[model samples]
Each structure stands twice: as C-alpha cells, then as structure tokens.
Target chain A: MSTLVLPDQQVRVENTTVRHVRPTRRLGASLRKTLYRSGAIIGFLLVWELVPQFVLEPASRVFLPPLHEVLQQLWKMIISGDLGTHIVASLGRSAIGFILAVIIGVPVGLVVAWFAKVGDFLNPLLEVFRNTAALALLPVFTLLLGIGELSKVSIVLYAAFFPVLLNTILGARSVDPLLIRAGKTLGLNNFEIFSKVVLPASVPIIFTGIRMAGTSAVLVLIAAEMIGAKAGLGYLITNSQASFLIPKMYAAILTVAVLGFVVNAALVALEQHFSRWARA
Target chain B: MSTIEIKNLTKKFLRSGANESTAVTAIESLDLRIEDGEFFTLVGPSGCGKSTLLDILAGLSTPSHGEVLVDGEPISGPSLERSVVFQQYALFPWLTAAANVLVGLESQARHGQGPNKADRRARAHEYLRLVGLEGVEDKYPHELSGGMRQRVAIARALAHEPKVLLMDEPFAALDAQTREQLQDLLLDIWKRTRTTIVFITHGIEEAVYLGQKVAVMSAKPGKITEIVDIELQDRQAVDDIRSTRQFGEYRHYLWTLLHRHGRQGEEATIDKTLITSGASA
Candidate 1:
C-alpha cells in the first residue's frame, strides 16, 4: 500500500509551472495530500495486523482479527458473491433514503427561504425537530411504520433531511444583497432573479448541506439496519459477530467505511465542479 | 432622448434597532436635471447622498418626497431603459463574462426590441468588445481582475442600449493606472454612444475629468451645493486633459467647494492626493 515511486521529473515541471500557471502546482499538492493520507491509512493497517499478534492474548486475538484474515474473508465473500449481495442491499437502501431526503429537502428549503411567511412558520418547528436526533425516534418509527424497509428508510431520511434543509436555507439567505440589487438594476423580475441570481449563487453552499446529508444517510441507514434489517452491511456485521466470524465482521465494517468515503468523495467532486466552474 | 428631471427629490430611512426613533435622511429636497446625451457627474464626501440619488434615478430606491422623470414621464421601478454600474463591480459571479452581459440583453429580448438569438449573442460579444474586453467571453467574474470585472460590469450595463446609464463610483475600487485607463475608455465610449450618464464619485479630479457638468453635493440632508459646467468640450482632442490648466482649475474649484461645504455632520479631512492632483501644474 505504501509503494509510492518518487517522481524523477518534478523539478523541471515545477519550474515550468512557475508563477502564473497554478493548476499544475495545485494538482501536485493534491497528489501529495492523497499520498500522505494513504500513508497514514497503510500505517494504521500495519498496526492493526501486527498489534494483536504480539500484544493481545490468544483468547482476545479472536476478537481483534488481523488485517490479512479480514482481507482473506473479504476476498472469499467477493468470489462467492455474498459481499455483492450485502453491498447492493445496503447501497440501495442508503441511496433511496438519501435521494428521497434530497428530493423533499431542497425544494422545501428553497421555498421556505424564499417566502418570509413560510420561513417564519417553519423556522421554529424545524429548529425543534433538527435538535432531536433521528435515532431517538427509532422506536416510534418502528412502532408506527413497522419493522420493515419503510421504518429503516424513514430513519435514514430523518437523519439526512435536516442537514440538507438547514444548509439550503442558510445558503439562500447568505446570497449577497449587492447581487440582488444588481439583478434588480439589470431588470430581472422576481422569478427571474430567484432562478438566475439566488439559485445559482446558493448552489455551492447548498452542496455543503447535501454532502453532510450524504454522510448522514449512509451512517444512519447502517444503524437502522443493525436495529431491524435481515440483510445489509450492518446486518452482516452483527450476524458475523454473533456467530464468532470476527474476520467477516471486520470485512463488512471495512466495506461500510469505504462506501461512506466513496459517497463523500463523489459529493466533494460534484461541489468542486460547481465551484471551480464558477471561476472557470 | 433621456432628459432626466429631478423635482424636489428626498429619501429617508428609519434606523433599525437602537436608533429606530430618528429617521436618517439620506437625501433632502434635492433637485437636478440631466439633459439628453449629457455626461453629468456628482461629487461629494463619502456620507453625502450621491449614491442614493443615483439609486433613485436607477429606480432601485424610491424618492421619499418628489419625483424623477425621464423624458417628462415619472420613473416607476427599475427598468431596462435605465441601467446602473455599481462601484463593487456587481457582475454575477456564477456567470461567465458574456453570460453576465447577456443578462441585460435578456430584458431587451423580452420586449421584442432586440435582434434574433444569434444576433443577440453577437451583440453581447460586441458590447464586451466595446468595453475593451476581448478573448474573455468564457471567463467568469472571479477569474478576472477588479478592473476587468468592472469592464464586464460596464458592458452588462450598456448591453441593453439603455437610454440613461447611472454609474455610482464605478472606479473607486480600482488602482490609479486602471482608473485613468477606464476614464479615457469611458470618455471614448461616451463620444460614440452619447448616452445620458449620471456619475457619482468623491474624487474632484474624477468628477471634472468625466462630467460635462460636475455637481458638488453637501452631506447631512444631502443636496447639490453647486453645478459647475465644464467647458472642455474637446476633451477627446486634448493630449492629456487632466494635465491641462483648465482641467486643474475645475478640479481645484470643486475641491474648494467640497472643503468648504463637504460634510455638515462630520469633520472633513484634507485629502493629500487631491492636493497634488488639484494643482494647476
């Protein structure tokens, strides 16, 4: 994992990418950042593999499985298509809940922010709900909606919704009034100004909320699955742990972490595209 | 002809929160007329209501007491016929340079007063070129320098072929070299377009250099103290108008007026730069 080859031609490249052309230096810096992160992760994995062998007793070693055993189990599950099934199940639930949250949250947030009356009414109500954690309402959701996909998805939705909604309101509110005044002088009517100026200006900030919600959706879905679901990454983790399949449990946990990281990376890319395109 | 007429104009804002009792009078019973195709500039200290007056003329703000008329008709709300260039270069950040200019063109297209879609795009390109910004159609506002951004803003303001253009200290944020360059560029553009302009600035040199008639304004119940008609009719023909004796005299006179009746509510600090620029050297 730490097989990083030193780039021999960097000196010439850095000199050529001097003062004006900045993207090359930025790209190099980003690569360096990624390398440092990968190095830390590799260092952690090495510690995980080695620490249990020398430090833990044989009885406790079963609980703290080595990295190679986890990887082996992960590979075996992949070859047998078991990992794929759990991944598909987990991803589908997470995506559905996240998409639904976004669909409901964004427009509602925009409308609420745009209309003073709607904002005045919803602000206090939203403030109350946002403070109350989604997991706190899990039993209520299960009792009302039953221990099915609906309840699980509802938990994810509830977890994800507030971040998206609140951020959107903040983004819309944070639009520069100077821009609005400029829009008026440019002869843009109310709807035109809202669509052209307010909407576009708020997008980068709105994406921040969506990114937070993305993380929440996945995390909350996993927790919800552990509570009720029969087949998901979270369920697999609990099941393998109950059966003393520590390696398989570790593998599932690793998969969930990777999935969460991937989702976050994709959202970060989307946000960067919007913001960078604004300057392009 | 966009003959702007100001009749007993006034504007007041009720102070928010702690000082909500007394209304802040930004402009009080101000009256001024800008003729068709005239290059008019308003000069005052920072607290004076020159920007407020410009905003009222642009219809971004309503007059509290009297009215402003363009071509003998009372101004309503902000319309395409009157465009404004703001000091901060209020170009839309999300849009490319040409796209920002296209925003103003959209108003013309709405009224069927503009050309076809293709010509409109061409016209946006043309307006950008008119402001000396070429090969930057796809560049967004954040990508450009402050001066370039302001040029894009000027292009946007002029894109609709507005009968009157109201500029509120448009070059205040720019560097000295860029400001001078833009001033000459603006003069050249005004020569060709002949659009009625109401420019607001605190600099006496900028006021004299730009306006055919420079209106000196006093702060605290803001009103025009004097309107000095500039006689440098062949300003374009001169080698360096700012260096001319007549130009210096106009700048010095405006500076003296400002020094005497600049701000009624605050102490007027002597500007060091104006002392040299207003010199008849």
Candidate 2:
C-alpha cells in the first residue's frame, strides 16, 4: 500500500482488490421483502374470497359477490371474446389520442423553450389553456366534432397534450449552461449543440412527461367513453351497472385498472431504455 | 511568436432588468500575451476576472473593449483551433469517454481533408490512452471519478489537436494526490505535444509548478497586476524541480503578489463582485 497525504485526509492506495459483498448473502432482508410483497396480494385475495363467503349475508352477496364468482364471470367474458373487444376498443382510442399528443406536444415544447421570442409569445396562452380542464372542454369538442371517435379522441388529446408540452419545456430549458459552453468550445454550432447537449440532458424529464401524458390520455379516454361510447371498457362498466350485473362491471373496472398499470410499466421501460447512460 | 494577444480587453455583465449604468465589470483593460508553445498560467483570487479573461481568450465570450487575437487574427467566436477544458468537467454525461473525445474529432472531421471515421476512432482511443484511461472507452462521465472525468475532458480537448488549449482550473476540484498526478501527466503531455497552453488556477504552487510564466490579477474590475517568469532548467524532472528551493521562491513570489493585490481590492467595498479573488485568503 502507498500512503498519500491530502489537505484534508490521508489516503492509502491498497494493491489488494476488494470484492463487493453480494446483497443476496443477506437472505433475511430480501426474504422478508419478497414475503411482504406476496403476502399483501395473497392476503387481499383471501379477504376478497372470505368476506362474501362467510361474513356477508345472502342478500348482501348479491351486490358483493365472492372472488371465485367474479373470476368465473371474467373467465366467461374472455372465452366469448367480449373482454378482448372492449380492451382493444379502449386501447385503440387511447393510442391514437396519446400518439397525437406526443407528436404535437414534444416539438411545440422544444421550439417554444429553445426560442426565447416564441416562448414569450406563447407562454401566457399555454398557461391559460393548461389551467382549463379537458373534461370541461368535452361539450365544446362534442359540439364541434360530434359524439363520435373524434370527440372522444379530442378529449384525450387535450388531457395528454399539456403534461407532455409543459414537462418538455421544463426539460429543454433546464439544460445546464456549462454543457452548452463546452459544446460551443468544441466548435459545435447552435443546432448541433441543441441536438447533442440539450436534447440528451432533457431526456429524463421528457420521459417523465411522456409517462404523465400516457396516464392522462388513458384516464381522459375512459371518461370520454363513459360519457358516450358503445364498445369500450368504460361503456361495459356503465351498461353492466345499469343492468345490475355487478360482477361484469367489476371485471371491466379491473381491466381498466390493469390496462393503466400496463401503460405506466411500458412507459417506465421506455424511459429506462432511452436513458441507460444516466444510470451509469 | 505569441499565439494569443489581449489588447486592453474588457468585459461587462449587465444586471437583469438593470440600465447600462448598473452594469458590473468583470474584466477591464487587460493586456496580456501568451507565447507560442509555452505553458502559461493566470493566477488570481476569486472575482479577479481570470475566468473572464480565459473565456475571452477562448472566444466563448466577446470582450466589451479592445480585442483578443489568436495567431494575429481577431477571435470572432469559438473554433476548433482553440479548445477549452472547463473546470466543471462538462464531459457530456450522455457520451462515453471515447465518444466524448470523438465529439472534438467529429467537428474537426466535418471540414475537408480531415480524418476518416476509422482514423477518428483510433485518435480518440489514442488520446484516452494518453490520459492513462485504457479499457474504459465506454465509461460515461457519471460512472467515472472526478479525476477521471477531468482527464477525459483533457483528452477531449487534446483530441482535436488544437493550436491552443485553454484550461480553467481543471484540477481545482480534485484531491491533492490526483491533482499532483494530473499535473505531472499534463507536463508530460505538454512536452510531447508542445501546444501553447493557457492554464488558469487559484493555487500559487500549481501556477509555479505548471507554468513557465504566471500572470497575477487584481479583483473588482479585474486586470493583470504582475507577470512572473519561472526559469526551470529541467522541465522533465518536475518532482525534483518542485522539491528544489528555487520552486519555493517562485511560489512565494507569486503568493505575495496575489496576497497584495487581493488585500488592496478587498477594501474597495464593491458589493457587485461578491466572489472572492482566486487566492484562498
């Protein structure tokens, strides 16, 4: 070992390499975590199964059916391809609206943020529009485009756009000045600097925006479908409820919840893929 | 021949929403010349405009008065011929070490009669090796240590084969041992490359050890107060030279010059220049 003295501390540079201890070696900690996660789900299912089976009277069980009955109903829906139809319908509308929001929002955000004159011109109007709710604009969209796919998609678009645009603006503007200067010193022009330095720096935030937009788009699509749609999960829930089919309504609600979770997971995966450099 | 010449250069920063009369002067009427292929250092306390001066020389910032000429021509803006190693590392966190160096080569390669893609990769690898970073071609800036990041920045600056390398306290953030190690490595690189270097630092010992000539600056509307010539017969044996009494004398002289100027400027009571001069005092 060679010893070196610094202004604040003495450092010993050891020739012998140190091995990292495996986290798995601490079995108790990891085992408890696994057990806790599994226990929560299993425990929840047990309560769902038992509450209606033992605690609830026959009359109450009419509204809150046992877990197995609900599962049976869901299974029947799947076999008949009804669940698949509703899922595909909901996903298609959400996809179209969210994708449109991304295409328009990202570039508009970057352009406004990068160009000061443009940002100054648009910021006040953006804030005003963002504050006004997408749900509130439902009547306006229906009046303009009619109660069809366009109106439903437009509402989702409105809901998804602001989050992506606002977050993107924040991302592009928050790029460190030091990095910009470094690019300049390396003889990169403004366009090159923006593409190389600013864009990469903004990736993490932009992904956050995308994730937010995805969630918002799914939410707004469901709400729009609830207001006026025939084949989607939202319509399935409302129709089943009106007809007193509690199990089918619960299945539709569960499907929508699962779909939202899946969308979030997919977005998280995309964020991880694009910003792997940051994890380093 | 002087590679860089500053003739009465000045820089003023306008306060936000403030009129012209409220502008703060970062540099004023500074005249300096850096010789070709020479290791020159600018040492001053905080707010002494040493960074401003370097920025002006790098052509990253325009001088409000007079001009900075590189190779007898005025510097209009940043060019591939003059590159800088920023104090913050600024290694483009998204890029790996090799790719960071490649950024310089890519820009230079855009012009005709430049290195091909294969040669540019080879040169990037060569520079990384020169900075003693091997088998880490794919390591991103965030994955590396502070010293390693600075070394990558140094390698990136050198990869372009710039006529002048401008470094703004590149070692200021490193530990003593790492700083010393980098100092020795830099001297070795300087000997081999023989590129004109203008290094900025706050440490008197660093200035004495690395530079053939050191310029000291005063704070509050900063300007160069003194320039000291360092005569070292053996630049190769830097460790031995640093241990000699002559090195102590040079360090002491520069320290005294900085101390005097720092004290004189401290009493001015100018609230605008809150940053202490380069001197630790």
Candidate 3:
C-alpha cells in the first residue's frame, strides 16, 4: 500500500510539473488554441456583416438586408414575445418527431440485424422506401392525414426514421466476430452475446446514424411547416417574407439555424457520454 | 478429473464454397490424451490446424468426425468448465479489464464457480493481480499495451476457475522480451493453479520450455507425428532454464522433426512468415 501511494503521487506530480512551473504559458497556449479554432467562423460573420452594408446595391437591400437590421428585428420579436411562441411550436414538433423516430427505429433495426430471416424479408422493402424521397410523400401524407400537426410530425418522423434504422442495423451487423467468439467461449447464450457484447460494440456506429437522423428531423420539420402551418419559425419566415418584412424573415431563419446547432451539440454531447471508453 | 480424450477427431474445410469434392483435411484422425492438470503444448508447421484443434477442444467448433471428451462427457458446445484465451486479446473494447473479468465470473456462476456476485468481483481482482495487472483493472483494453491486454485476457480466462484452459498462440503478438516474460509468468501461474492447460504454438522454444509433453504435427493432412516428454530441473526457481544444454537438445530435436520435409523433398519450406499466423472460420 505504501509503495502504491508513492507511485500515484509521483505520477500526479509529473503530470502537473509543466503547469506548476509556468502556468501563464499554459493559459496563453489555450487562448491561442481558442483563437485558431474560431478564426474561420469570426471571419465568415464579419464578411456577412460587411458585404451587405458596403458591396450590395440599394435595390438589393430589400432582398439581402444588413446583419444589424436582422439582429434588431430579432430583438424586437423577442421583446414583443412573438419569437417565444414560434420557437416553442417549432421545437415541440421537431422534438416529438425526432424522439418518436428514435424510439421506434432503433429497436426495429436491432431486431432486423440480429435475425437473418427478418432482415431478408425487410431488406428489399427498406431499400425501396428509404430511396423514395421523404419530401416526395409530403403531399400524400398531407392528403391522407390532413394539414394538422399529424401531417407535419409524420413527415419529420418519416425523414428521420431511415437513418436511425439503417445505421443501427449496420452497427449491429458490423460488430467484430472475434468478440462474439470470445463471448461464446465464456459460455454466453445468444441473448447474452447480443446484449452484453453486440449492443455496446454497436454504439459508435448507431450514434452516427442518430446524428444524421437528428439533422433530418429538423430539416424535415421546417419544410413541413413551410408547406402548411399557422405558427413556427418556418411559417414565421414565409409569412414575414410575404408581408415584405425582410429583416424579420432573416431573423426567423437565423433562429432556425440556432435551433439546428443546439440539437447537433446535444447529440454530440450524448455520443461522447456513451463512448468515452473509445477515447485513446 | 479434467482428462481430455480426443478419439479419431477430424476437421475438414471445403476450399470452394458449396463444393464437396475439394474439401481439404485440416485435422485428420487426430488422437491424443491429455491427463488431468497437465501442461500440454502442441507444435506444428503453419496451417497444420493447431488453432483448429484448440477451437475444437474449447467446444467452439464442431469436428467433422469423432468426439472430444472431458472426463468422459462429450462436448457439443461451449461450456463454463472450458475457457479459451485467443491470440487476439478479445476483451470487449467498451469494458474495463475488471468488467471483462467480471463477465467470465458471471458466466461461470451457474456452474457454482464463484459463491456470489461480491465474491466473484474479489476473485476478478485476485486473478488480475495473479497476472501482474493489479492497478490497470479499470483501464480499457485500448489504453493498455499489447502485453497488458493479453494479461487481462489471461485473467478473464482464469477468473472463472475453469477446469481446462485452452490457449492458441497466446504470446505470438508480443515482442521477444515481452514474450519471454509472459512465458515465465504463465509457468508460475500454471504451477500454482495446476489447471489442465492445452497450449498451441508454432515456436519450438515455447513448446520445449513450457510443456510437459510437446506434440509435433505434420501439415497437408494434420496429424501428430511424435510426442516428446521434456525433463528439466528447477522450472519453479525462475532462473533462465532456456540457456541450459538439456533445453537446447529438446529444441534442436523438435526443429529437425519439423524440417524433415527438406530431406523428403516434398516442399521447399514451411512458410516462415506464417510461423505465428493461423487460419480460422
């Protein structure tokens, strides 16, 4: 125990020796890293702000408003409480559709991948349906389900489902056969092998599919809303454009971008949480 | 009571898919007896079905003919009593070393190997310590070195207290120095546990050093040619017995036995690159 304690302490000291000697250098290095990481985004934003203000003609100003004007309109909508209502409507529809897709698609994928008979029967159908565009079915879904939340939500679910299902099947199927052999040697049954070995091993690939589905969910939801909806960011953008409130339309579009960014960030965080062991 | 009796055991792999005529014999009428609690080593030319034989003993693959019995009970599938340590350290990448050991313990719980869950965990730690991997139990396989990962694999194989341990070129991937170190470590553990071990390797040095009975095999229809009983002194003392003249004599004898094809003019060489490589399904 005494020997163990000394080695651990020595390791800790070795790890932090540079920091202890020159803490300012470490801080400066991190600051430089941050600057380098964000340099491109900062440049892009500056270009957006300056290009419309200086380069574009006055006639083009109505179509491509200045960034500050769009920001000001965004603030106006926030203070007036109109932005909150639209955001809630859009988020609710997207969230419900995405979550539903995940809840249904993942298990179906697991089942099909694990059992060969099921996979053989469903493979051709899936190939056809997944290839036939989700947006192509928009009019059909609207006509069948009516233009209520059902149609919009169903469209989002349809768009997201294939990615989650296909990726999960691929994930489950791609598990190292060596790992399964090891499990069998340890006396694991088929179910035990599936749960203990196959499921955990398939996580990284499955997460990749879910990330794709997450992007799909948001994009499909916005498209559905643009086609037919009383409220939501897509509806707001379309309505503002129709009313010739160009700045507000730009602001609503920015809000939609922010929402997509947040969903992606959340999905990435979840992926890291599950697969931290994979980090070298 | 873990005596393994292989009675006319044979395995064949079809060269082309769905072709019955071109079936190549991997193991042909292989008959051998491994006494209880003995360290057995098998050596052969590359592609001589040494790994295939190990897989069959572990109940991982079915023999085309005949049967393998452990204490007169024929095995049809994998059992908790027989644990296998593959050359590829097949630890679950997502699991820590401790969790991997725990998997083995849990598998053997039905056989009443470990008393309970808590005792099983303690045994897992004990086995890891036995393999000289005391502090890295919580580390994932990728975080450890190749030798360390193989140690975890050994710990997992032994943690369940199996009656027989099957190893297939377990140290073939390590560097020369690490390989020697693990060889010594394995000897020490085998001495203590007295578990029935069937080790397969292409290295003649490994076969001579660790095995009580080293069986030499021939390829093109894999079958045992000769069984050499090694008699050496002070194996438990840990002084390098490999340098001794008696060890050299056994090693040279096995080398000549493997190289007999040169005199016969059947094949030029035994595929030197495949000295440590094997094929499997």
Candidate 4:
C-alpha cells in the first residue's frame, strides 16, 4: 500500500507542477501570436512595395502603378481640395443612411420581437426583402428617383437597413428569459422591461449590427456613385478611371478604403465606450 | 401585512409538435399561504416546478388554473409589489451594479410615487450598502465575482422596495462557502428589512437554515408535500443555529423528504434518457 501511494503522490505532485507552469507557457503562446501577426503584415507590405520596384517595367506599370505613384497621387489629391469634397460627400451619405437605419430599424425590431404574432407575420416578409440585394434595386431607384444624390443616399439606406433591422430583431428576441424574469420580479412593466432590461442587454449585438450596416452603407454608396454620380469618392474614381488616370483612380480607391477603415474604427471606439460594462 | 395566497395553482406548458403532444403539467393543485414578513422557502428536487410556482407568483408566468393574491389582490402581471432574484445572476450585464439598481428605482419612480433622480440614486446606494456592495457600485457584473454579482442582483431587486421578494435558488451557482456567506447576508437583510421573502431552493440544509417555514414540494405536476415550521428560540446567527438539536432535526426531516423526491427525479430522468436514446437508436 505504501509503495503504491508513493507513485500516486508523485503523480499528484507532477500534476500540480504542470498546472503551475501552464500560465508562463500561455504568456509565451501570446508572444508568439503577436510575433506571427506583425511578421505577416510586414512581409506583405514589403512584397507589395518590392513587386512594383523590381518585377514590372515602366510601360506595364500603367496597369499596376507602383505604390509610390499611388501615394504621390494621394498626396496631390489631399493638397488640392477635390479629395476633401468627395470624401465629405461619401461620409455624409453613410452617416445619414446609418442614422436612418437605426432610427427606423431599432423600434421596428423591438415592436416586432415583443409582439410574437407580428413577428410571425412579418418575419417572412423581412427575410424576402433582406435577401433582395440593394444593388438589384439600383435600376428602379435611378428610374424613379433619378440619377441624383437622392438615388445614391437611398441606395445606401437600403443597403444599411436590413443588417440593422435583422440584428436588432435577433438581439431583442434573444434577450435572456432569466433577465426578463428578473425584470418582472423587480416589478417592471412590459415597456419598462423592454426599455430597461431588454434594450440595454441587446446593445452589444445591436452595435455589431450597426457597425456592419455602416460598412455596408459605405460599400453600397461607392457602387451607387460609380453607376452614376456627379460628386463623391466613387465618382472621382470612376471619372479618373474613364479618363485613363490610373494613379489618380488608384488614389481615389485608396481614399475610399481609408475612409471605410476610419468609419469602422470610429464605430468600434463608440461601441467600446458605450458598452464599457460588457466583458472585454 | 403583505401575505401571499397561492390558491390551486396549476400550470401546463403546451408541447409543440406534429402529433399534438400532450400538455406538460409543471405545477398542479399547489396551494400555499405565506404570512407577511415570513422567511418562507420552497424546497424540492429539480423539475418539481418550484420555479414555475414562483414565476406564477411573480406574475412572470400566468398559472393555467387558480390564482396568486398578494394581500388579497389578484396578481395580473408583474408589479412592483413583488420583486424577484433569479437563480442565475440576472444582473443587467450592460449596466454597472449601481446603474442596475438605479434602473429598478427609476422604474418604481415612474409608476409609483415618483422620486427625483437624486432620491433614486440615494435609494440605490442605500440598497447596495444593504447587500454589502457599497464600495463596488461602479463595477460591472462581469468584473465582479459570482457572489458579488448575485449581491448586485439582490440589491437591484430590493431597490424597488417591493412588499414581497421572490428568490429562485439565487445562490445555486455559488460554491458551498460562498453560498453560506450569502445565506447569512440574506438572513441579515431579511431581519433588517422584514421583507416577505418566498425563497425557492433544492438545498434542504439551506431551506432549513434560512426559512421560518420550509415547504417541501413533489415532482411533476407539483404539489406541497410537507411544511416544517422552524423555531429559533435565541435569535442566534445562522452558524450558531446550525449546531443546535432543533436544526439537526429540521435538517433530517427535510433531507428525508427531499431524498424521496430526488429518487423520483432520478427515475424520471432515467426514463427520459432511455426514451430519447431509443428514439435515436
């Protein structure tokens, strides 16, 4: 019995030691993650910069303009005031569209979720419309609203609306039954439960939807502008492309990418600030 | 005096399926009367529909048969008269501990005797202190320990100053040590506030320790099996009472009652598993 117990105790001691050593191993694992991520990004950038420098001739560079030329065109656009107007126009469209989506989508989502009968009736309708791509409606919008800012803005709204509405519905519907019970126990009415418990609990998911909608809004606006528009970043890119100014077209494209990135970053920051109570 | 009268409460959940499945009776013919300010507990095995009974009383779920009356008034829906602390720490994760409590107070103010924001905040702070979470008001639920989160849930429930408080295994998730600590805190709060509490738990020791009257319930289509009235002669602390002969007797009695229900639950679960496995196979 003593001999058997000695090996068992040794095994227990080894297990404890292994548990103690695990956290340091985790730290090393995290370090490896950071190293891998940075290495991949730096390697990609280096290859992108080097490919144009060494691999391509100057004549063929018209199709794939070097990073430097694109950067130079970008700088010129920034200095000149043409880029600013286009960027502002795109930003304004996305902002208005996203705001409209939230205003209409959130309340509608809440009402639909709260009333099961209404949700049952409307779900198929929403599913049908949501699946119908906003791009598909571009022709109709152009005919009805004309090829103006209204068509462009409305297109952005249509693109953004589905995500916000769908996410809000999902968020509202998925509120923890326990939380609702807890709300009821606290003597909260239906509306109080919705406003105080359900809405606040759904914020993180709803914000995710809003962020997705914001990105979609920008993407759709760009495509809409490219179809037919006098102003906006998409217009600048299409105009430059049509005129065969490859560098300037690339510059406009880069600006749109940067604008989308900034908007996403801003929304993420807002989500973090508002949902400070959520687990990181 | 805010007594609760639960009369012939029966709840049946409709099972949705192609076969038009039979209604699952959660609670059946359950009648209980909790005196105002009594520390009453409902103890049973899981699936005994103890929670369903509490839900009906809280007005979260309507009973298919009979009624729940608080001070002779029928419960229609959730009202501030009865507040509940759930088994799971249902502290709103999006709000800080204080803010969650504030939500309760704000709702109360909106419907009841309205108070200014300052007054509401003060009331929230007061309840937070009562739950021993005064310094951690700004902490989010995820940031707090399980014990602290449950305390915040309790604080939120109490902030509304409801006449009756319904608790459904609020300490079920806590470890034994933490559970005991919370149990004591609950007793202290109950003593100070004299809030009529109807606590639901499967823990016999816990039911025996805190309850002035422990009502044992039976499984599926649940009904009250037995009621044990606890007498604490010296008004001793929970720990002190645990060592007494009367406490041992009460514990033994509840344990025996709960054991019978536990065996029934085990048999039901085995049957269910076998049927499911059979279907799959």
Best DockQ goes to which candidate? Answer: 3
lDDT of 1 by residue, B1-281 (tens): 39999999989988777845678999999888899999999999998988888888888889889999999999999988899999998888888899999997886787677777898899999988877777789987776777788888999999889999999999999988778878877887787888998899989999888888989998898999888877665665778888986677677777777887634454434443454454423
User: Which 10 consecutive positions of candidate 1 chain B have the poorest summed lDDT?
Assistant: B272-281
Error of 2 at B105 (Å): 0.9
Q: Which ranges in model 3 have alpha carbons more than 4 Å from their true place?
A: A1-23, B17-21, B110-113, B236-238, B262-281
Q: lDDT by residue for model 2 over A196-263, one digit each (tens)?
A: 99988999889889999999999888888888888899899889989999999888887898899999
Better of 1 and 4 by lDDT: 1
Q: State the fraction of real interface contacts model 1 keeps.
A: 0.56
Off by over 4 Å in 4: A1-42, B112-117, B232-245, B261-281
DockQ class, candidate 4: acceptable
* Runs of candidate 2 exceeding 4 Å displacement: A1-19, A22-31, B17-21, B235-240, B264-281
Q: Is candidate 3 or candidate 4 better by lDDT?
A: 3
Which residue pairs does candidate 4 place in steric collision? A185-B83, A185-B84
**Looking at model 2 chain B, which ten-residue stretch has the lowest summed lDDT?**
B271-280
**iRMSD for each candidate structure, in the order shown:** 15.9, 7.1, 5.8, 13.3
Alpha carbon lDDT at A121, candidate 2: 93
**How does residue A88 of candidate 2 score in lDDT?**
93
- Give per-residue lDDT, candidate 2, residue A77: 99
Poorest stretch of ten by lDDT in candidate 3 chain A: A1-10
